[model samples]
Target: MAKLDFHIVNRIRAQVARLGDRAALRHQAAGQWLDISWREFGAQIHQLALALAGQGLKVQDKVAIFSNNMPRWTIADFATLYNRCVTVPIYPTNTPQQAAYILNDADVRVLFVGEQAQHDAALALADDCPQLERIVVMDESVVLADHPLVCHYRDFIDTYAPQADVAVLARRLDEIRMDDLLTLIYTSGTTGTPKGVMLDYANVASQIESHDQKLALDEGDTSLCFLPLSHVFERAWTFYVLHRGGINCYLSDTNQLKTALPAVKPNVMAAVPRVYEKIYSAVHDKVSRAPLHRKVMFTWAVNMGARMALARQECRPPSWLLQKSYNLADKLVLSKLRDLLGGNIKFMPCGGAKLDESIGRFFHAIGINVKLGYGMTETTATVSCWDDQCFNPDSIGMPMPGAEVKIGENNEILVRGPMVMRGYYNMPEETAKNFTADGFLKTGDAGHFDEHGNLFITDRIKELMKTSGGKYIAPQVIEGAIGKDHFIEQIAVIADTRKFVSALIVPCFETLEAHARELNIKYQDRLELIKHTQIIELIEKRVVELQKDLARFEQVKKFTLLPKAFSMDQGELTPTQKLRRKVIQDRYHQQIEEMYEESHKRSPRPH
Candidate 1:
């Protein structure tokens, strides 16, 4: 049932041949939509490959792409593979030091930079990375005249002979094998140093094949590409979209998503949980401030939509009256939610971290399919995702076709399939430690399967906390439970080697401010506002109510209200909005220590 049997290059070539004049990819420039036809895409890739070859790129030479999501990123990626070169992707949010480490580790020779930031990062690493010879800048706005090593993307491609034959590129494509190394994706390194996950042509091809079997995306579909292309989830998902001959809309600025979504009206998209969480919060906050009648109407519509959704999932038709209710619900409320994501979104894939069940259900209740998925960089982005008919908000769904998933020792999720990466590039010991003897990659995530075979992730194995009382706690579970509160924007649970659980909380400033205004409470700034007793009591009450499902020991006993939220720029969050636990702990050591101190003083134990 695999949709693809050939390698990625051939697959893309086939798409170009079959859908020659169609818009294969689209991006906005100078406030206008521009489309690149399949034929043009193919030609650009060919020219870029030859230009790379002219610059002395050889088989297996590492080519680094440090860029935001754009059409040129994919063109450069496929062109590298066309020349039998390895593509090493560096996240756009990565600091210059991080970029230097990857470039030096991968020994990248030619780096394709997207904009001024990435180009500057590459230039900063010039002295450190001896192998890096040329810099191809994608953004034409960047001005670099005196530099001999740097050139605009168009100018770089023009350097190659125009008469270069397509037959030679065809011969090279024929030489490619399924097992040949294709890309090196570095881990986000929340815990420690980043390691490059080695993936081959077979790994990517197999994922596209398996993924197509699970999801029914077709040629007519359009996917919005906004997440960083450096992440495997977006990168691989984009590849699948291209293979299906779908139009890809690239958003260089994530801040423009709210505007872009309605403008593009994409049929499909994938994003991290933060995006949906923000959307969910915005929707609820708006409804909360609405008139009482409007609030009641919205609630009714949501309930009706949920009923209709359940009926559709069970393949049962709703009764005539219920169907009429759902129609009204869609017209009055559900359709407005859909409009936020460009009304045509058939389904949007969410991954990179655990999605709160409340947020997931809310999307479903509004007639939007937020297919919660599970995977890591090592699995080529998707190990499992919701199927066409069976959708579950609590679990990450069944394994992708041709992929095997099972619970191993410590309840860690184990995976075995062609989609799994070969190993960590140049780190044999780390790679060996990551896999079982039989070749199954040990995904460090702890999870179990339901009777219907849905995978429910509990927490990360390494992130599990052990209290001094010898009880193990899943921080993510506690975080997910309380983090969905209307007033709490972000949370991090702390319990390792401690007597009880605690949290560092970031209040939803907007909601908190509105509440403050209603209560006639005034403060100079966020610091003074979070210190207000009334605000603390409000968040505390919400936390207590939310933690009712948690066991006594697992409940957060004490918490500190942070004045600000964790951010990727501060190195406290990863590119995907996952909190960097160690970094956050280190940065807030004073606050964490104070919380434990207060707990000890409040509940002194006999020695």
Candidate 2:
């Protein structure tokens, strides 16, 4: 039996009692920072829960939140839990059809909407979903006139406050068992419909406990959260941050990161690999445009800093000359780079996708500790995370405390822990298929334990590509190897049924255009620029250099330059910003076919 104290609602109540007037959350409203104290946070949750109870939300009733990353999103999440109702979070960027499917599948009766877009999306979905009975708008400015089921957030919460039955809600909250369903997180499937992953209170509690054993946060620390709360990684991380009594600063708009980093200067934050990739590109772009002498000096300083960083990571003392060189490097070049992320950063935990090793090393070279971890929504967001004393660019660190990991048949990473989710919601067949007879969850990721007991993810089992020559190619490895080029923003390797590997490359227009200017290359737009002879030569040179580490068969033989980068809007990227390989290949079938046409003509032994 799980203790009631380990439950999330109880943990929030404990924090309210301990912290009192201490600021718990910070968010922007009308362009001004507003702080919600621990007591006030509790009060809001209590009132919101009372209102939910007024709406006849019984225990285990499904409620949904369709919102961006905001203070209200966090508050509403707890409010739903306080009423003992399961919360379903739909990503803010999810299409109306996606949101509707989740609502219908989860049987969500009451939905808390965020901004105008989310409100409109919900309204559009309400007619299709018979189970959806009411819509509560989080933004006060939303204008929904004479909608029978529509209610302002304030009106809804305040309506039942006067007639609230606190005792009943309290009893329900107390009756919440650890095995009770906490959330229904729908993971987008590779094929067919998305399935809802049912995570119980015990699963979440175990995640918190396991992560806490690996790392502890300071009470005074502040964390900036920009990732969507609908994603398990950010949601679990936020819960952990709150448990530690740290202040959470929510970024409603991801585009505000550049300005918010300086203003908030958060001590810790977690982000996906794309964030680091963009920063790396920007840094290199500026260096490329610098004077020859400055460029040479910067390169020397960075090399010296990387040497020192490598030495420190290995627990070896740097040579006296290297130490002096690093001191000068840190003073002259690295310090300014650190300032870009608001030098107060203690560490930034990066995951949700494979982070390029070069980018990780670059940040570490300049004093930013990017803790790369590996996990999924099923594992409650973190299985293993790199620590202070141990950092490896290749490994995702040892198994986190309380979590058991083993490489099973076909090198599949098998995880068995309290942190693992119970099963897919309402899909017992899928639930049975995903888990082994003995209960270990098949991660679908092919990886192995290194000599030092660190875990190295080789490739995704389902995503591996097999060519006609009977060679298996890991496209992610190929993509990661070449995607770090300053001019290449994104790359997707395509070779599944083909004779040789090729790629669909999206250039980093910012760097490429700057180089074009230096070379006096003329172009009307990106399409024209990519077609230029010099531009093609430049990309070819970069691709050749980047693929030097790859095997002859694994190397990209030919690639077509894409005029535009892959984006979520086009269904080329997932909500978490990972590339949808199949989608990209389908969308650009012509270009991919063109690359293979030449190969078909050259393969003499083939039909």
Candidate 3:
């Protein structure tokens, strides 16, 4: 007897009602304060949902939505849920083919588009998808395509919206159940056509509950959200913030994070490692440009912190002098570094990649409590997270409350709990193959749990590669080295039936200039710089230096720096900005082959 709990949504509804005139949403539109209260926020969704119901839409129907983090985007999402339909959020930058695959496979009958580009992508998809019958644009674009059914966002809601029937609405609300499907989040589709991971209402609700229990704060807490809503981590976290009755301000877009961060000074925020990496690089780059004395002082303090950061408390000597020295360094150097992450930051819940321990330690040394977590799209967002008080620099965190975790024979992380998704939509084969007979989801990530229940993600099962020398090297380690160099943007290692390992690299043009200047060289465009023998030798020399720390097997023997890096426009990088090794390997097969071509000519490479 599964039934609609409405625990989360009802709690938010009550808070909005109580908050009344208090501003619940804020956006800086054209230097003007565009704000809305809880009442208006709830009313827009109410109207949007009622209008959707009036369109003869049935419960559990798929409603696809595409947009950045706008107030209306959130409204459309909750409205779709209140109307008892599945919310299929599409990424704004997704290719038309990827968008078309999701719409057709999910059987999305109604679409809520964002703007001109989104509408054009939908229009391109319309001819291929038979189920899509309506197109509604979210922006103020008056232009309409030649589709048989097209309407502006406002007109569509007004057309299908019903006058509030209090009794019917309540009854409709009652009919909803917790186990009912609430969302179908499509994978980034970097590996293949995106498969929709269908999450139940209870799945989402339980995650919010877990989050509220773990990361509760006083009322009046604020968050600035910029991640794509199509991702479950961002979407679920947003609802949890509303559940906390926290004031949330949506950033204009990813491109506007700098302009938005200072404007909406939030107390709490969550971001992937890339954001933190950029912040770290900015601080380091700026410091390198300071006076010789200041640069030396900064470097000395940072190095002291780095040394202490990688050590466990048990490893520290019982000397107060060393501790005092570290404390002083933290005060002088580390504190300034953390202040860059918005000094008001209570916790930066970083995830979506393996964070460099160095980066984590640099922030921690300065009194900034940067907590790291681990999870996936299939687990309904978060399964393990490092809390502020109880955290380990080396481990991701303990398994989430009541979430059962076990290691498979193959070392794959397996999770069995209410937080796991029902199954992939229209993917019986994938669903069946991806699970155990008892229904535990088999996470393809390789990991292990210590006696204290702390989890350590080791490597990805699908990404492990072996060289022709029969020595295995984790590509991430090599890739991490490449990433550490400022000039390197995106890189993928090649591991085939070959004698040695090689890499395809894309240089960061902005950073490349400074790197070239350091070496007293000149270059024009990206292509010219990458192909220059001197610049190539500089990167190769760095690679040799880095490989000195690695084993002979782990060393990148030969490398080809590409003119362009993986872009979202290309199918090579995930929307989260993770490297798609397989796609890159496929794209640059010839370049990889050249690395081994002159290997015999190697002047006895250093291990």
Error of 1 at 258 (Å): 0.8
Per-residue lDDT tens digits for candidate 2, residues 1-607, read 2467778888889999999999999998778778899999999988898998888888999999999888889999999999889999998888899999999999999999999998888888788998887899998888875678899999997776666688889899768889889999998654468889889988888877876776658996999999999999899989989988999999999999998988888889989988998898888888978899989988998899789888877888899999989999889998899889977888898989888788888988888888898999898888888877656777888888878999988999999998899888889999999888888999999999988889989899988999999999999898888887789998998889888988889998978888999899988999999988888878888788888878899988888899998988787888887778888889999888877784554311110
299-414 per-residue lDDT for model 3 (tens digits): 77876765565453235553576568778887887766655655677777777788866677667655555768788889987888876554577788887775788898689999
Off by over 4 Å in 1: 1-5, 161-168, 599-607
Which order, best to worst by lDDT?
2, 1, 3
Error of 1 at 271 (Å): 1.3
lDDT of 1 by residue, 443-530 (tens): 9999899988888888889888999999999998998888877788999999999999989999999889998999999899999999
TM-score of each: 0.95, 0.96, 0.92
How well does model 1 score by local distance difference test? 0.87
lDDT of 3: 0.76
- Candidate 2 residue runs with Cα over 4 Å from true position: 1-3, 319-322, 599-607
